[model samples]
Target chain A: MTASKDKEEISTYKTQPAEILAIRDLTDDTRYFKLRCKDITMNKDFQYRPGQFVIFSLPGVGEATFSLSSTPTRRDFIEFGIRKVGSFTEALFKLKKGDTIDIRGPYGDGFEMEDLRGRDLIIVSGGLGAVPLRSVLLYIEDRREEYNKVFFLNGARSPKDMLYKRDFIAMNQRQIIDTHLAVDEDDTGEWPYNVGFVTQLIPKLGELIDSENTTAIICGPPIMYKFVIQELLKLNIPKDQILMTLERRMKCGQGHCGHCAVGGRYTCLEGPVFTYYDVQHIKELI
Target chain B: MSKEKFPEFVELIKSKGKLFGPVKQKEKYSFEEIKDFSELDFDYQRTIISPKKFITPAKYSTLRFVKFGQTEVLPDDEPQIVMGVHPCDIHAIKILDRLFLGNIKDPYYAKRRENLIIIGHSCLPDDKCVCQSTGTDMVEDGFDLFLTELDDFYLLWVGSDKGLGIAIEAENLLEENVSEEEIQEYVRWQQERSSMFTTSIPSYKYLADIIHLNYDSDVWEQFGEKCLSCGTCSLVCPTCNCFHVDDKIMMNAEEGIRERMLDSCTLPYYSMVAGNHDFRPDRTARLKLYYTHKLKEYIGRWGQPSCVGCGRCIAYCPVDINVITVSNALFEEVCETQEVCDQ
Candidate 1:
């Protein structure tokens, strides 16, 4: 079978140890994690784009996919904003600071930052969608001179349910990017931003920038896609310029596992980030 | 090799390693370890399961772990010779090799594949066989040795160095030269076998386009209504290599072993996420994925359909949903008159 000298095989399934440097609660059910590779050499060499994800293996509990909430500009540590939703998350929540876990990848076709350079950018995130968008937001913030006008619109169910409240408020205070925060309802009445759906903020952008030079990146709940895309289209933003990150149940982050397959593509390989023009024909894609 | 010398050739193969061949049990044929040459049966049209079970397996432990440390459990490194594989199954194995042994090599599958040797046997088509349509009726390679049975002798084609080694070992039993009459006889046998195929998908070449055009057709729902969701099609198919992994904990809660087993896309919750979100919630969508992935999507990725037309899905599906019926329905776009769409 060994007919010719074969290229070195890339071990897709192998994982390295990543120790938890810190763990902080983002909300009642969600937590923000900061981790670094246990090996010093691996820690320095680890590189990933904003929209990529990692597979967190808990050994006996099995493995699950999580997005990298931290940007690559911050090379010291990797982060994930995980919600306690299922059995895997339930076990993950029990782990304390300084604990170690098995992680692999940086998989998926993340956002092409270089492609979006010099283009007017609008980043819209809602609920837990902020997790992945946070990475992109921080990436843009570090290299603010590369892009044109940048806008960050974030939404949550209420004040208490919002993730990264402190960090976003600080960014809003800095006035570097046009940061807009919206709450579905201001139950506490202490909210300082708009008290309606985040889709309402989309119209405010109509008068600020030229739609032809603009690119909109959105990540939100399944229901938010229809309204957000409709508003973006009304503003004359091109369909191909409208990018979104998606979620799917994945075991192997590589293309081997069929769990993330949609139509003819795999979410773990071809996507997690797709243009509206690319998936508009797919009926199953939201 | 003549018919009388076949037993002696079999003995030579047995001396190499553990040999497995098709055997009849309970009126069904399966590949089982051969204890004696008399137990070998080569007349079967198809086995219950394809030869994929020998490589990927239905279930196997991938990693054994304690509380803090883990180690990969590689398959044992013993030479294995599988005899009597057909052309369609050989094509299916090639498809698997492309997926598992391609850019990202699966260590477990690679090890098992390297250790196993293939010995192919020619087959005549039955009513359910559609290999002729799928273009997998004849395998040019992917086997150590290929045997085409003539009237009085077995014309052995050495496909690899391993096969050449075996041919060298049993040189006395093999005919050194092909006679003029024997060459004509082999050509005639090939022509006769080619004409025996009774089932075919006429528009198989354009199946990818046809399936894409009819993605929203009602034919899938009709098939879905009758499907039991028992995952029998995937278990029997040679190219269906999707797997689900589970971690088994010890009774003491100290250690566990992660096991991977064959999974089917048509089964419930095949695309479900952690937060109870199911991408393919209903049977119709899941069933559509199964056919589209094999017949349409595979072509886009691999330049050919993954279905080699072994007829296992035709023989095994309780609801009569097979590649032939599904492809024809999509191609014609007329499922209203079929038995499935009548309801």
Candidate 2:
């Protein structure tokens, strides 16, 4: 019987205490939060890949999902780019720098960094989608030599709404990887990047991208997928090579909660990141 | 065991733990606390809710939060015996066990499950019972004790060590040996029960494929239009385990408890993420998720559909829409009324 196995069993629902280390505003609505496990052992041992997420439980409020906005290469502390959208995030936005919250899991199948080691990469993001893709870009930056030519295309509503604007500007200044930033309408006349959708930037990669060798990673609003995917397909990128991270209502980061189910697959289990080929047949997937 | 000795055996089992069995309440049947053996109405086809409620209550506290941190709140370790469970309901419990006890075990569910002792009883099929098609009509195991009632006595089959201990303790009231004639009679009873099934989901094996083929079918819109979204189907379903969690603060405001409650996909916000993006915004989409998850997706993952064909949806759905009507509509392209398609 499983009764004897109970002693060694760690409940999936069990959460660890995490204290806010730092907080900074990326935009009026979105903020960058850095948190570390209060328990030294847990903080030291915790490791997660890019594109995975954690469930932030705010006792007396509710629990919400947040993608890991930091890279695994960086040890101890984890970060999230949270937008004040709902009551949970509203409460989350109120907490100060030293406040503690319950956090569990480094769940979901994140980006496969090792697999894309030798491949050319095209990282794309728009709006809050940059939160998870930021982890991927930073990971590649840390291990720049392992991968081939890398191109980043980011878009936001405007200059003021852009998440991690300073970081992208700094990366662009570094000039090690090709970085292209765009905004729908730049309210700040001083904004240096292109003034259109991110999809428009894909054409500039015309001769630079080796279609067969390149793995395109995209994360953005639902509307961005159609036009962006069209551009990527025009470049002849294989369906399986085009990976996009998705968002769904998730309570438990584990597959126990059925909210994140897309067709037969649980987005929290099989993916929050899925290959275009994987979900092409699933009608409900957006 | 003889019919007269059954009451004495029940008394012995009641001493073991809190014994619960099927009891009649007004016009409906439910699994309630059995104060006496007479309260057990095993003649009924099904209960309003399966034994799942005992395992995962509609609502329970998972974590209790204080000033600094939170503590896990597990169900009390009181041993409970739920008797008179039908085979299909037992199968449903087994499915719940596999989900809640398999990889990434739910601690709360695990605790409640460990404290439960299942005692199944044989039941005859009614017009609504479709377990024959779902293949959950008979259960060989997953129960501590199973009683198959005969003409004048009961053939008690012990399935576990706990049941064996009970048999040993009640040996004074139990018949140790049975005749070859009685064995033949039991076989005859099994055949008669098998022939009694009048309901089945035809071409059950192809339901998954058909559901996929009809993903864009208008039949969903028709059903969704009638759906009340009351979530009664999921509540009555033995296998529906989706839940929503909330945090409730006490009046003092210093302490609170995180509560887990049963949630249905048909509900308004089952698939709504923060920022209010509802993946399944309309009734049609949500209704599709409910049926597809149970009928098609479960088969892909577990090699069997989650619907045990206990027929709770058929009996309880206020609207005339159910697995039978929906499946028939998809399979035969027929509706309950001719005007349904014409309109």
Model 1 has a DockQ score of: 0.62
lDDT of 1 by residue, B2-90 (tens): 98999999899998888999999999999999879999999989999999999999999988999779988899999888999999999
Mark the regions of model 2 whose C-alpha exceeds 4 Å error after superposition.
Answer: A1-10, B334-343
Note the Cα lDDT for every prediction shown: 0.89, 0.89
Over 4 Å off in model 1, which ranges? Answer: A1-9, B334-343
Error of 1 at B330 (Å): 2.1
Q: Residue B85 error for model 2, in Å?
A: 0.4
Candidate 2 residues A164-264, lDDT tens each?
A: 99999999999767899999998889888899999999987869979999999999998898899999999999999999999999887668778899999
Model 1 TM-score (B-chain only): 0.96
